[model samples]
Each structure stands twice: as C-alpha cells, then as structure tokens.
Target: MKILKSTLIATTLLMGISCKTSNNHKAQETGLRDAYKNSFHVGTALNRDDILQTDSLRSALIGKEFSSITAENIMKSMFMHPEKDVYQFDMSDKYVEFGEKNNMFIHGHTLIWHSQLAPWMRSISDSTEMAQAMESHIKTIVEKYKGRINSWDVVNEALNEDGTLRNSAFYKTIGSEYLAMAFKWAAETDPNTDLYYNDYNLTNKAKRAGAVKLVKDIQSKGIKIDGVGMQGHWHIDSPSIEEIEESILDYANLGVKVAITELDVSVLPNPWNLVGAEISQNFENNKKLNPYPEALPDSMQVKLAKRYSDIFKVFLKHQDKISRVTFWGTSDKESWLNDFPVRGRTNYPLLFDRELKPKAAYDSILALKK
Candidate 1:
C-alpha cells in the first residue's frame, strides 16, 4: 500500500485548492471507524467463525476498522429459530457478547423475511396460524435482544422491482398488510430499538416507491419504523453515482433513516444482465465472466478503489439521512459472491482480500475525509 502522498492527493482533499499543507495529520493514524466517525458508522457483517477468533488477524481487523457489527446469518430465521418450539441462541449469544466486548453498534440482520423461513413455519395452512407464528417469532427474538442489539431489519427483500409485494408465503397468506403487522409486532416487543425494512434494488424507481409506501403506510397507522435499508449489492460501472445519491435523498424523504446495507462491488462479469441481488438465481460459470480467478489486475484494483471512494463521497454528502454503511462480508474469500450466480468463481468485492489484508479500496475510502 502506498501512503497517499501528502502533496498530490491528500493536500488536494485535506488542505483545499489553495495548495496549502494540511496540519490534520491525525487522519493518517486512525482507521476507517474514526475517519467517518462523525458522519456515520462503518460496519461489516460477521459469522460465528469470525467472531470465535479463529483468525487472529481478521478478528483484530474487525475490532480496529469497524465500529458496528451485524450477524451475517446467525440471526436469520433458520439459524436463530429453527423449530416450532425451539430457539437457538448459542451463536447469537456469542455474537452479542462479541459486539459488547468490542463496543460495537450491534444490528440484527432480520426478523421477518419470506426467505429463510423455518421448515415448521412453511407448513402452516391457515392465515391465522401464520400470523400467530410471525408474532410469536418476533416477540421471542426481539425480547431476548431487547437492550442488546441496537437495530433490526424487521423485513428483508420483501418488495419486487415493480413496486408491488413479492408473492412469498407471508404475502400470499397474510397479504401485503402483513408487512405492517410485522413491524407493529416488533415495535411492541422492543419499542426502543430501531426497525427497518431492508431490500435490494432500492435505487430503482418502482422498488423505492414501494418501500416509501410501506413506510408511510406503517407510520400512518401509528406503527413504529426507523429506517429503510438500501442494500448496495452492486457492480462496477453500473448504478451510476447520481442514481445512488438520488435514492438516498428519496428514502430520506420518507421520514426515516437510510442505510447502505449489504454493500459489495463485484468485479467479476455477470452471467446474465441481472439487476438486484437475489440468492435464488444461478447460472453455469464461464471463463469470460470469471476472468480473474487468481488475482485482480492492477488496473481493476484501482477501479475498485475509485468506485468505493465515489460511493462514500455520496454517503458523506447525505450524512444526515444515512445512519450506517455496512459491507456484506468481512473479506473477499468469505463473500457470498463466489457461489451466488455461479459456482467456484473468485471475486474481489470487499475492502479485504482473501487473506484478510486491506486492499487498495480500503486506503482510497480512508483517504475520503468528512
């Protein structure tokens, strides 16, 4: 990694256009958490394996660079509450403990979602039973982490691209109104904690309109809602800077905070021209799409760095409306990109590489001061 020379880049940003030298050298010493501490929290999603401290280097990096923690999968429905009468807390307990020990802003990944539905939950044949099950699940989990977790994604990926409800089991049985009920139930359980409706393709006009409607409908009914998480599952050269910034302002207008949740910039080529990050999609891998299977070329690394820098510049511009920007995973190797739309394709989509070393993108992001 090269020190961003004090003259060319640093001076230009830190000192201004007067060609003066900056005395704010402390920015060089602090990690990203401090760099953007005043603007918004810098966070990353973690798994039990990372929290257990299996890799001392990665664990240390998490503690140093980030000020917020979110469970990548443990807090999901399947892993947290897998049975009708059973609830698993071993991993979640550890995750909370880790957050407390590190003084991190702990965030629950999700509470209600059409995906990752518990097997027993799927067997419900009546709307009444399904509603009861949803209420019970939210109450139990929210009560357990009442004061532990800071905020929650009350629902995840619940809207379609056309601004209508995705016909998942919950939407089909209980209808779009079920989304409101879900937030109400969560608020009843833990009114103090923040609640958000998180989804992908949030920058798209139709999808964002649907989200804004959900928030307005809930608030109009006197239900508690805190934020709308715009999952930044993006690729290079797409989702232009103007588009993302526009989405931020739009979500901010809904009288709720906006979060860039599940953020990662995939460098690999796409198998097909897809838009949002849906886990169900997959295609056979081709070498053209999986070009850099071993290492990212220098030119691509620079591109990745600039991409992140440009995004953060937008985040800084909308600090009042934004609460947090969380990377989808800790490192490139752990990123779900490898097997999502294809199988066994390496990707460089995170600040840290496979070995957990900070990449050029990290430095570029740090160079961006608030």
Candidate 2:
C-alpha cells in the first residue's frame, strides 16, 4: 500500500472551485447535529487500499469522521465457507480487527442470503440435518464475534419484489419461519448485539410492506430484533425520492434502527449490457482500468454528488430514525456496484472517485452539519 499525499489532495479539492452556496434545506436543523453528532455513521466496504499492502487508505479514512465499518462480502456466508466445512476467517477477521482498531462500529453484513451461500448448504436434503447445520453455523459465527460485533444482519434479501419469500435454500427447507427463528436465535446467542434484517431493492411499496410484516411477525413472537438495513443501491433515475422517503418512514414506524447500507448510485448506459459485466469483473481486480464509456461525465458527476447531498440532507432530517449511512466501497476503484449484476460497465456510483479524492458528493454529505 502506497501512502497518498492527502495534504496535496485536500488542497486540490479546496482549490478546485469555490464552494457552492447551500440552500437552507441543506442546512442542519437546530440541535440535530448535537443530538446525533456521532450517530451519523458514514461508511464504505473494506477494500484493497485499506487492507492489501498499506494503510494509505486507512489513513485517508482516519481524516473523515466515519460512523462505522461495513464488512460487505467479507462476512457473507460464501466468503466464510468458500470450500464447505472449511471456514476461513483470515480476511474477515482482519477486517473486524481493523474496525476495532479504528474504534469504528462494525456492521456484520449477512448471516443468511440467497446469492452467496455455499453449494453444500443448498444441497442438503434432510430437514433435521439442515436445521441443525443452520443453528451450528449461526451460533458459531455469532458467538465467535459476540462482544466484538455490535450489530449483525441476521437475514439479508429474503423478500422478493412482490413481498413473497424468495425460494432460498433456507426457505425451501425451513420455510419463511426461518427468518423469525434466525432473529430469535441470534438474540439468544448474542444478547448484547442488535439483530437486523438486510435487503436490497426495498424502496418500493410491496417490498416495504413485506419487510414490515416480517419484522412485525418476529416481534410478535417475542424476538429481540433491533434494526432493519435497507441496501440503498439506487440508480441515478429510478427509486424516486418519494419511494425512498416512504421506505424509510415505513421501517422507522416499526420502532427499529433504519440503515442505508451498501449504498451506490449507478450512472451508465441503460439496460445493463456485457461491457457492464467486464467492468464488474475489473472492479474486483483492484487494478486501474479505463473509465467506463457510459460513466457519468463531469457534469453528471456533479449532479450525482448533489443527488447524494440531497439524500444525506434528507437523512439528517430523519436522523432520529436513521442510524447509519454506508457507501458500498471506499472509491469507484473498489465499489461492488461496478461488478455486480453487470460486469464491465464503468460507473462512478460512490462518494469518492478512483483517485480516493472526495468528489462533490463527499462535500455535500459533510455539509449536513448539525
């Protein structure tokens, strides 16, 4: 890891252009800042810059008052069980250590998900064995990080677009009841930790309703759930502001912590093609590549930044309900938005650009002073 002369970078941003005048709407409300000064947890996924070979990225993060650390894929079941029964904790442990070392809150990404599960988990046939295995895995992982992790996303993306349970292996075997059980077990296993249900594409009425019902069901069962994580993977155009606000309000109504997790706004050619696929692949490689042709132009980048600013401003307005805001990765170089669903599509969907410099989006977010 090479050290970046951040003094130079900060100077450049300061001199890039005059600061734009902010509308009163963007201004912090009275006491809002002090009330939740440290509560607004801005974060991103663990990346190569922070972990590969140096602390240059970590040093960069230190300058910002980040609220927490998101493990992203590190805490996923697949990463933890890459070879089936062979749990490797090296990388994920390093990240957890990094969070504690920095005194940043740690968000354990997912305990259950449909996409990242190992084949063995999906291949199990006997119901008894499956349930027992699920219990063992959850108990072991939760117990291992009992004191260290303050929050755990016990279930991730379990709802389909129509609010039905996705036919994940867990659902196939344990049925929808698994969600309630998972939350209950997690609370029992780590009584001090907050349990959350995490999901993407939740900025819609159907999905929001489904989530509310799920949370209600768990609570009705006397479960000790604490929060709901909305994976804020938005497009530049879709997921209208009304929808976003509604989603937040709906979840907050449940009396739980609402988090904007895995946030990134994609700006690229529509319909998502093969070039997008290549871009996604390259993003994970952690090496520099040519920017995607359809990426936001400089003007678009500014618009994107302003969009994030507006959203953060809204988040501040609802600070009483929201607890955390996490970007998907440190910079465009490491964001999962680049490689997911589509591969090689170039996109600038985060607060930082490839250079690790705070783009307008960064300033826009910081402007939300209490």
Candidate 3:
C-alpha cells in the first residue's frame, strides 16, 4: 500500500483524487484510513449521544482511519449494572448499532473487572452464586451482541501491579479459575468475536512477563483467548519506547494478537512534581479548553504532537503483531485525565484539542508511511 502524505495540500489532493476514484481503493482507502488520515481505527467511546444524531463527529471521521468503536464505560460491569439484578442493554446495544451503521467494528470494553462491578456482586458469599452470576452476565451480554461486536475485552486489569491475580471479587469468590471461565463463557456465547485480556503497565518487565504467562496459562487450559490489549496510557516522559516495543513482541510471541487500547499521552502536571503543588493548574486553559485560546505557545504543543507521532511510529513498525489501536476519548475535553489524580484539573491528552481541531500529533500520525 502506498503511504499517504500528511501535508494539508497532499491530504486535500488525495481526498479529491479518492473521491473520483473507485476500483483502485486499497485497504487504506476503503476500510481504513491512510497513516496521514489517522485511519488506524480512530474512535471514541460514546454514552449520551444518539448515534443517529452524531453528525458532527460522524462527518469528521469520513476520511480518517479507525479500527473499531470501544464502549468504554458502557461495557464495564458497573455501567451495565448500576443496580443489582437489573442489567441495562439499551445504551450498549445502541453503541454497537451505531458502529455497524457507520461501517465501524465494535469492541466490547470489558466483561470482567476488579472495578465497576455490580454492588450485589461484591456481597456474594457463595462461590456457586458468584460463578453463576459471572457466567450468566457474560453469556447474556456476549450473546446479545455476538455477531455485532467483533472483539471483546474478556478480562480487565486482572493482574496486580506485581503480576499476580488481583484478589478481586471474582477471584475471591471463584478463585483464579474465573479468568478462564470468563473467556470460555464469552467464546461459547459468541464463537466468532475475538476475546482479549486488557491491562495497564504491561510495558514493565514484570508486568509483561505476567501477561505472557497469563496468555500461556489460559491457552494451556484450552480457553478461547485471542488477544492482549495494552492500555497505552503513557505520559509525556514515561513508558520508554524500548519497554513498549518489547511488550508487544512478548504478547505476540505467545501467539496472541496485540492491541494498543485506551491510548492517550497525559500532558498534565509532570510526574516528578507529583509531591509538590499540582502543576496542571498552571495551564489555565486545561478544563476542556473553553473559548480556544489564541496565540498559545506553538513549540510546546508541537513537542506534544511529536510524542504522539513517535508512539504511532513504533506502532506502525509492529503492525504485524498489532490488530487494533483505539484512542481513549474523542477529544481532549472528554479525557479521563482531567478528573484522575486531581479532580477538576484541566489536562490536554489526545489527538484533538478542545475545538475538535487536529493538533501537531495529527501531522505526525499522517507522516507515517507504509
């Protein structure tokens, strides 16, 4: 495939050329976006917006590339089951329907997690009841969207920072067996959809080894595991490039597809200043960048874009092992970083600035060539 150039003039020229062309459209043209177009499945998790009414965002993605739509909070156990015994499917089903309508693949955010589980799920004392509930929930959700959802996060953050099974509710009730059971039940429910294990900090040596062992262990038990999702939540300075590339290879060596899920580079208060007064507050336009500031420092923002582009460069080099790459949020305004660590602090950590305009990172992503 010929790589698309990132220049505005080149993009306009390509768009015009692609508009008049038909038979020659490549995978990068028809199904995915060219490197210059942010085409590697650019997407955002949705909750409140009506799929039919999201013309603004829909129009924006027309020529951009994206892999799938991930129902971030929608698919999480807590969001699906805010109350005990009363599961909601309206929102999630809408999300999948939207993806299908837009010719976008759908990825289930998660089936199991230590966080965001139903309240009653936490109170279950009997192993049988816990296992039954888990199986039922997984079966119901997976079956409901079987053909529609192309991929699923079978388990989320299952391992501790040290790479051991987290003593979460599921582990406490059914032991480590729950991981295998969750994948088995999900696969049984939807034999075609890809199943994945997703987590953060997989770039660390111990964490990477733990993920490798987890995949091998699950495969050893004859479970239907298909992928490993690395939550690429990097900061401007952390998660060295060497660690990121090595982790991708480790997961692939175990015979599972790898994905950079929940990718975003946090440009908040620097980590070194974590103990001091919050540094994020100093960036006055942080909270959603309301009333876009004119004459902002171009160099700092350019550096930020380079950071994102560098990561994409790494991703492109390992595209053989990677199956998908999903951005965490649609815009910097909607990023989770704003509230994380310190609530109400503004942070810029995504491809688009507050005005839905592409940042320098956009230039870098477009700079990628096949």
Candidate 4:
C-alpha cells in the first residue's frame, strides 16, 4: 500500500508540471512577436499611458507582445517641440526607456510633418528661415535619440490624394525642396539610423506613382532613403489584397524596404465613404454610423477575424521585403479609430478588445503561422 501511494503522488506531481509547461508553450505561440519572430518584427504604437506604466495591463501587454514600438503622439512636433525653444522630453524619454527595457526596436514617429506643426514654425514664410527651422527641428529631435532610435519617419503625409505635393507650410515656405532637405538633415544627424518617407494611400495607383517618384527623386539626389511607410489605416472592405500587394512590390522595387506603419482595420461602416486618414475630418454620431455601439456582433467578429487573417496572409507572402508590421494601437479600447473619422462611438478595430483579452482576430492571426 505504501509503495502504491508513493507512486501515485509522484505521478500527480509530474502531471501538474506537464500541464504548466504546456500552458506556457501555448501562450508563447499566441504572442504576436513570437508568431512572426522569424519573419519580421511585430510592433505597436505606445500611448502616454503605456509609456508611464499607469495601466499595468497595457504596459505588460506591450512589453510581452510587441518586438518594436512607435510613439503614438508624444514624438510629434506639437507635443515634442511645442515652442521654439521648449523641447518636451519627459514623456518621450520614458518612451525610449520602455523600449530599451523590453529590447524593442524603437522607431521615431516623424521628424517633419505639416499637420501638427507648432504655430511659430508654421508662421515662418521666408525660405531661409523656414529651412533653418526645418533643419533645427529635424536635427534637434534626431540628435537627441540618435543611436537609441533604429528608424525614423523622416517626413509624413507630404503628398495629396491626387499624387501632387500637398502644398503644406513646408512646401509653401520652401517649395518641394523641403522633402529632400528633411531627409538630408535627418541623415546628417544620425547617419547610422534608417530614414523613411511615410504616407497613407500608397495602394492607390496615382499615390503609389507619386511615392515612387518621390523616393526616386531622393535617391537620384544621392540621399540615403532606407524605406517607405504605407500607413495601414484600412477598412474591412476597401483596399483589396491586390492593391496592398502591388503597393508593397512597387515600394520594394524602389530599392528601399517597406513597413506597414500605423496598421488598423476599422470594422465600422464608412461615413460618406471616408477614404484617407485626415484627422480633421469628422462626422456626427448616430445609430446608422455607429452601428455596434454596445458590442461587436458575432458575425462582425468573424468578419474582423477574416479581415485580419487575410491581411496577415499578404504580410507573410512578402515578409522578405517587409521589415516591421506595427499596429496603430495595442487594443480596441485605445485605438485612435474610436475617435477619428467619427467621435464617441465604440469601434472594435484591434486584435484585443476593451477588456484586454485577445479576440478572435488574434487567434486568426496566430493561426497563419501554422
């Protein structure tokens, strides 16, 4: 009897250990970073709360799941350089620290952008003064985090929907030369870091052609343009796989890497067929627009899963040309989609839901690895 009891106890202990080990293995398989570890760096943008560690769940999820991180807003000019002389490094400092702690590939969001320009910088009309401000802005930010940031969006959204330059303040003040000037300053500031031109709607033929021309122009000038960022602010139905794939190949053909930056698939219906990610565009809230205010229905959830799976399929097919795929946010609750293009409407646009639990979309994306 004593021998039989001892054997049973030993068997029970071994079974417990086996169960724990299996659970851990399953968890590892589900992580985004681990699922695509061999393919590319899986990444997400970090908000201020994530940087401060105020929300324990978000902080932990970011550290565990993403292999790269982009500052969602803090690194932008309005936030980083609110005044000519004032440089806010507190939040951005914490951001880089978090990335370093997790051994993440830190990507500086933007060195020059027209949307969030400070008033002082925007009001400068003289070409020389504008050039000086642009150089100072790019060099100051780039020099501060020179070695720490592995890559940068040297310029963001400089082109319009019709493939011409947007005539932004930079363009109006300094002409189209500002594009090359921005890349040049960033390259000079940090020769070791990768510099990229980031924009939206590269899938459109006209915009794609414009991007090709832009990159080729920079390259022709002997500038070190490393990659192009196709902002993946997509919807469930639009931007078919063909467009995405074609855009990827076209950008790669430029002899520069392609990154799917700011990726998020909005599941909500497009209000008046919204196409671009212009933040100023807004529509009033109503039942017709904000369809799933309470909860995402089962059918919609399945649709979202299929959307994500199809998207990842494209990413995997051309993983060689792709360097990183960074989701715009970590979870649905924190996604910018919740506010942009519409206001105060519940939108489920991420792999994780509001409760910080992985949804069907997450499972579907992980299954692609098999």
Candidate 5:
C-alpha cells in the first residue's frame, strides 16, 4: 500500500509540472514582435476597421504581435484629402491615438503617389500650380503628425519598372525634379522624422538604379534622404533570395537605411505576373482563379512556412541595413491581395489565419534565431 501511494504521488507531481510548462508556452506565443524582438521592428499596416477599434480580437493581436503601425489607406491622398477644399483628420486621429496608447512605432504610409490621387490633384495643368500644391500637401501632413510619426514614406512608387519616372502629375507638371522637391519639402517640414523614398521591385536593376539616382540627387543637394522602403509584395519563389539580398545591400550602400515594407507572401497564382502594387489593376473573379476560395491546402501551408523562413533568414542577415519588416495586414483575411489583381480570391498571405490564429508560417519565422 505504501509503495503504491508513493508512485501515485510521483505521477501527480509530474502532471502538475507538465501543466505548468504548457501554460508558460501558451503565454509566450505572442508572435512576431516577441520572436524578432532584437532583430528589427515588426509591424502591420492598419485597415480602417483596425484603427477604429471595431475588431477587438485583431486590435489585441496587433498589440501583442506588432511593435509598429502604418496607416494602410487612411493617410493616403484619396482617403485623407478626397476633396480639393477638404482634408479629413478625424479618422487619422484615432489611428495615431491607438499607436500612442500601445507605444507602437507609428508611421505615415505616403505623402505623394500617382495612384490613389484625388481627381482634383490629378487635373492640375500648370507646373507652378502643381509644385505649390505638393508643397502644401507635404508640409501640412508632416506638421500635423510631426512628433508622433517616426517615419514617412515621403515618396512612394515613383519609379517605373524601367527606371524612369512614372510620368505622374507631380512628374508631368513638375518634371522628375518633383521627386527631389517632394522629399525636400517633407524634410524641411519635419527634419526629425526619417524620410524614406519607397518603391516596389527593388530587385529589378532598372528600378533599383532609378531609386539610387533619386536618393543620390536629393543627397547632392544637401537634403535629407534617410532610407528606402523596398515593398515586399513577393511570391512563393519568384524573386530569388539572391536578388532580395542584393537589393538590400545596394540600398544600404547608398548611405540610407532599408525597410521591407508591405510584406506578404501570396500563395495564389498571379493573374498577369503583376510586378508592382498598382491599385488600378483588377480582373474578373473566375472560380478557377480562386481555387482556395474557402480553404487552403495542407501542402500549400507547408510551402508558405518554408517561404517565410527563407525570407526572414535573409532579413536577419542584412539586419544592419533594414529598419523594419512590416506585414501589409495582420491576418490572412485582411490581406489586400485578396481583391487586388482580382476580387473575391481568397489569399492566405499573412502570418495569422482568418480566425486570428497563428499558422505554421508564424512558427517558421520564430524559429529563425534558433
């Protein structure tokens, strides 16, 4: 009887220890911000619903997993300054307040871009008028959020795939010099904030060359050009790991920091192999295209896990040049790729699944330092 009682006590002690261990592990799984704490700033772009605090689970997940926030669309020209005579700062105030309350690094997505421009801004004809308008736009926004927003994508997607200006209204009326002008006005308004010239497909030589030239031109004029945001709208394997690393180093060589901005690895097949994140692109929603409309295959989940691991390995290698690695959205459900290029296609591109649960991709990223 005594022997049996001793054995039972030992078993109970072991069970208690195991339960404690499991509880501790569950508490530790706060995701990216905790996993990559020392490596770089982990962030997500906030959708309107997220900023408005409408989704409690998402807001909590964002606070737990991310150390930074980007205004996905609220700060853009179309949303914030839709009408020529009107500028909306109400929704934006909530965004800033959320970031402040959480102590997350707040960032402004863009000051100027051709796509998503208000119709009024696009219709300007005179060079002088356009320049004056840009000056007001940059200065007003920067001054409003000067001390709060640590960085600004001062000029976004300004380079063509072939390393030429996009012939945007800013470029058309003000010439390519408008690129420098935008950055200059932004810097003068808030020199303390990190000024970034953001664009996509930095792995492409022509676009890379164009960005290097643009930054160098600004620097030559003794203006501030702090970093380059290499928008990480990558696929499962299209952009070779070598190309990504090369671009990171190339941008670092230009005497500027680098950021892997707007990151999301799409598992879906690209409609036309779209190279950049142009908001105007779309396609008819065919059943064939939205193959994973309801649920993703188990095999593809493994592929996504491996892809995230590989990309993060490169990011860890070039941590010196990179400032932040921001996911475009917090969960797979919120990924804009779902409706971009084609609407109604389910895209499992983010770290968390639709239920706001972490996936194997999350585990893979966490295992990088191991």
Candidate 6:
C-alpha cells in the first residue's frame, strides 16, 4: 500500500510538470513573424520607449513578434526636424540602431508631410524659399540615413477625401509639383531605398482612385514610387472584406507593392461616425463613447478576433502583391486609438492586452497560418 501511494503521488507531480512546460512552450511560440514568414513581412510601429528598450517586456515582445519596424513618432517631421536648422537625430539614431540590432526591415516614416511640418517650413510663403527649405529638409534627412533606412513614406496624406489634392502648406507654397519633387529628391538621395506614398481612408472609392492617379502621375515622370501604403485604421464593423480585397487588387494593378500600414481595428464607437485619422479631430470623453473602460467583454473580444481573421484572409489571398502589413502599435495599452478621436477612452484595438498577453485575435491570426 505504501509503494502504491508513492507511485500515485509521483505520477501526479510529473503530469503537472508536463502541463506547465507545454503552456510555457506555447506562449513562447506565439510569434507573428514566424506564423506569417511565407506570406509577407509582419511588422509593428515602435514608440520611443520601445526603441530605447526602456520597457523590457515590450522590447522583448517587439523583437520576437515583428520582422520589421517603423518609428511611430521619432522619424516624423515634427519630431525629427522640430526646428528649422536643428535636426534631432538622437532619438531617431537610437531608433535606427534598434532596428539594426534586431535585423529588422527599417522603414522611415515621412520625408514630407503636411500635418507635422515645422513652424518655419509651414510659415514659408515664397515659392523659391519653400522649394529650397523643402529640398534642404528632404536631402539632409534622406542623405544622413541613406544606406541605413530601407524604405520611406516619401510623402504622406497628400490627397483629400473627394479625390482632389489637398491644398496643404506644401501645395500652397510649392504648387502641385511638390509631390513629384519630393519623390524625385528622395529617389535621387537614395537610389537603393524603396519609396512609398502613404495615407488614410484609401479603401474609400474616391480616395483609392486619387491614390491610383497619384501613383501613375509620379511614374509618368520616370520617378521611383515603389508602393502605396494604405493606412488601415479600421473599426470592427467597417471596410467590408470585399472593399479591402478590391483596394489591394486596385493598387496591385498599378504595378506597385501594396502595404497595409498603420493598421488597428477599433472596437469603440466613433463619436459621430468620424472617419479618417485626422490628428486634429477630437471630442469630449463621456460614458457612452468610452464603453468597455475597465475590461473588454468576452463577446467583444471574440468579435475582434473574427474581424482580424477575416481581414488576414483577404491579405493571404493576395499575398504576392502585398509587401508588408504593419500594425500601428504593439499592444492595447500603447495603442493610439485609446486617445484618438476621443480622450481618456479605454480601447482594445490590438492583438495583445494591457498585460502584454496574447489575446484571442492573436490566436486567430496564428490559426490562419496553419
């Protein structure tokens, strides 16, 4: 009897140990890069802290899950060139180094953007002066990181929702030729790097048409525009699977690689059906707008998972044309949606929860690979 009891206890202990090991192995194996290795490059945008390796958990997760990285803010015009003559390369330098250390496909965000322009650049009214300033800004930044940076969003958000070019400061100053000029400068600066034009709401019919025209016009000039980045800032219900697929095919037809850039599916309600990622748009936070404040209900979690899975199915169907799919942020805790359109709202827009644990959406994405 004593021998039998000892044997039973040992069996129970061994079973527990085996189960624990299996769980640990599963957790370590949940990597986006590995699952989508054959399909396309899986990437995520990293904030300053992530690039600096300040948050060890985030740093490790980013390194393991993503095969490519984009600087969320450090490489933007406002941050990189805040002052006219003063270029802040410290943080951006660290950003490049982090990508190099990880052996990631490092993509520079924007060489010319209307939104985050420096005060001096935006204030330039003369055509010649504006041209010189723009040239200096693009040449200096692109030259400094010429060989190190792999690709760039040469110009971002240059079109309006109605399929017309936005009359931005660059446009008002340098005329419509500025778009072609920006790409020309970037191409001249780095003949090797892939240059892309990025923007939001590109899935919209009119906007997509505008992008098509924009690409063709640049190519007509014999300039190198390698891809068009469709910023996938979608809601759980929006941008039907058909529309997503159509946009991919449309952009692919243009002979430029398609990239799903700045992707995040928001599960919260838009205050007034607000569309597009205009940073200037904001609303007062209230209970109705900020639902799921403390915890996301199980039903919503499942819905988010389904949304991501369906979207990836479209991506998988046209994998040959797609070059990269980069999530805007790493985890829900760091997601920009939480604060955008509405402030102080808890948002569950990413595949990882606040604790940095993989959510159901992450599992669903991985399951598609199998």
Question: TM-score of every model?
Answer: 0.92, 0.83, 0.82, 0.92, 0.91, 0.93
Ten residues in sequence with the least summed lDDT for candidate 6: 13-22
How well does candidate 3 score on lDDT at residue 304? 66
Q: What would the per-residue lDDT of candidate 4 be over residues 141-195, giving only the tens digit for each residue?
A: 9999989999999999999888999989999988988999899999999999999
lDDT of 6 by residue, 107-151 (tens): 999888898778878888999998888888899999999899999
Name the better of 3 and 5 by lDDT: 5
- Which should have the higher TM-score, number 2 or number 3? 2
The residue-by-residue lDDT of candidate 2 on 113-172, one tens digit each, is: 777787788787776777877777788789888899978999988887778888878888
Q: Model 4, stretches more than 4 Å misplaced?
A: 1-29
Runs of candidate 3 exceeding 4 Å displacement? 1-40, 50-59, 62-65, 271-296
Candidate 1 clash pair list: none
Task: Summarize candidate 1's per-residue lDDT along 1-370 as a digit string, tens digits.
Answer: 3565633464344224112113324433677888888999999999878878798888888988899988988888888889999999999999999989999999998888878888888778789999999999999999999999999999998888999889888987888888989999999999999999999999888898998888898999999999999999998877899999999998898889998999999988876678678889988888987899889876677778879989989999899999999999889999999887888899999988887766777777887773
Scanning candidate 1 in windows of ten residues, the lowest lDDT window is 15-24
On lDDT, who's better, 4 or 5?
A: 4
lDDT of 5 at 15: 47
> Which model is ahead, 3 or 5, in terms of TM-score?
5
Between candidates 1 and 3, the TM-score winner = 1
Model 5 misplacement above 4 A: 1-30
Question: lDDT for each of the candidates?
Answer: 0.86, 0.71, 0.72, 0.88, 0.86, 0.89
- lDDT (10s digit) by residue, model 3, range 81-185: 766577898788777777777778688988888777778787887999999988888998888887888999999988876788888898988998898999999
Candidate order by TM-score, decreasing, is: 6, 4, 1, 5, 2, 3
